[model samples]
Target: MKNHRKGHLINKGNAPYVLLAPTILIFVLFMIYPIIRSLYLSFFELKSGCYQFVGLHNYIVLFHDRTFYKSLFNTVVYLVIQVPVMILLALAIAVLIEEKFLRGKAFFRTSVFLPSITALVAYALVFKVLLNGDHGLINYVIELFGAKGVNWFYGEWSARIAIIMAITWRWTGYNMIILLAGIQSIPDSLQEAARIDGATARQRFVYITVPMVKQIILFCTITSTIGTLQLFDEPFILTSGGPNNATITMGEYLYDNGFRYLKFGYASAIGYVMTIIIFLLSALQFKATAKGDTD
Candidate 1:
């Protein structure tokens, strides 16, 4: 009876693990293994499909690579410009959509949010055709207004502008949804209290609404930073990182190195460097958020 009871207890304890075993096994096999393997590969060079240990050589070379610096600069430009604009725009749209005076709220929300659900490739392809230098819809529309048709693909700044516009269009709705949720979570009583204290609408928004949703804003900002840093799809499809390498981001550089040049080791190094950058940026944001909260 004692042995039987012990086995029964053991079986009960093992049930959860048995149920979770498949998921756990899959995670280890795919996510964990790939990350570990990538780190291992980062330290070595591949030659003739064989690994040759290079210690820190790949990383050392990365530090001095002009293309890597150019890629980094391009990513930083996107992070600085596109991210803030998108975040603020999303926040504005979220705030506007939540107002009681807004007519046909459901329709407005759906119309705005529709882009978020659109496929990236589809969106990029559409933008590519729409922004084409010659005989494009946007230029055609401009011509309708009796204005000269400016070719988006022909100018460096225009290409960057077009890429930013595409990303902003595609992602603003998604971020707006996030911020809207954050806004809804805030209690109306607080806003009412601020109003009763003779605070203006703008004051309530700045003092009451913003602080309440600061965490969500930080989350969006950090995610946007990482996303912008890794931006590939928009530039890839739209400009191919061109009008000159003006749009060439780190992800594009990583792809070119890994696939085009077949410099797997160098690419691995670039990947790890980007991983470190993302980690550091996330940490900095968290630290800043904490400091802001304390203050």
Candidate 2:
């Protein structure tokens, strides 16, 4: 029995690691390997389907590429236009739905969030049909209001505006659900105390609710920023990066290089550049929010 006990003790030290081995292996295989491989590939270019070391040549080409700049511009527009509108709309919807006396809120909330659960491709197709230039349902409705229907995918600015609207439609409910969770996590007692102090509704919200939930708000903002910057599905499915490259985003441009044009090296470089951009933006946002908190 003493020998058996000693054997068990010997096995115990490595048992936890043995159980954790599969998870660690999977992470290394999928996450770590891809990152390392992509970085390595970024420094080489394919010629006649064979990779040749090119050093920083691919990155230099990326910086000078007109399409790359166009994609970066579209991505920034998505981040600036869609993100704030969605966040503000979500906050408003969350506040309205969180009202305890509101009736049938469960059904209403579920309906609003339904679009988010709809597959990206599926909803993108739906929007494409609805936004069709000549006989779309949306255009048909606008005709009833005595306004001429405009081709949504026709021009650069108009197409981008349509993209913004599509993004807002799809994501507002998702952010609303997040903000609602944040609202419910706040204590009721502080709200009640504010009411007793004769605080106006707007004042109470600005001072009490916003401050308390700023962390969650910050999280939603960072996530939305990342999502907007990496946006692909909608542009790919709805516009195919568009009639004149107007709606092309970084992801689509990357896809165009890696697969369509078979420029794997340049695509890898773009992917790394986008990764750096995302990291910098996220860090900047975090630092700014931290400063606000300190004040």
The 10 consecutive residues of candidate 2 with the worst lDDT sum are 154-163
Which clashing pairs does model 1 show?
none
For candidate 2, what is the TM-score? 0.95
**Model 2 lDDT per residue over 121-209, tens place:** 98999888998998889889999999999799887887888888888998999999999999999899999999999998898889988
Model 2 C-alpha lDDT versus the unseen true structure: 0.92
lDDT of each: 0.89, 0.92
Residue 184 error for model 1, in Å? Answer: 1.2
Q: Best by lDDT, which number?
A: 2
Best-performing candidate as measured by TM-score: 2
Candidate 2 lDDT score at position 138: 88
- Give me candidate 1's TM-score against the actual structure: 0.93
Superposed on all Cα atoms, model 2 deviates from the true structure by an RMSD in Å of 1.7
| TM-score (all chains, Cα) for each model | 0.93, 0.95
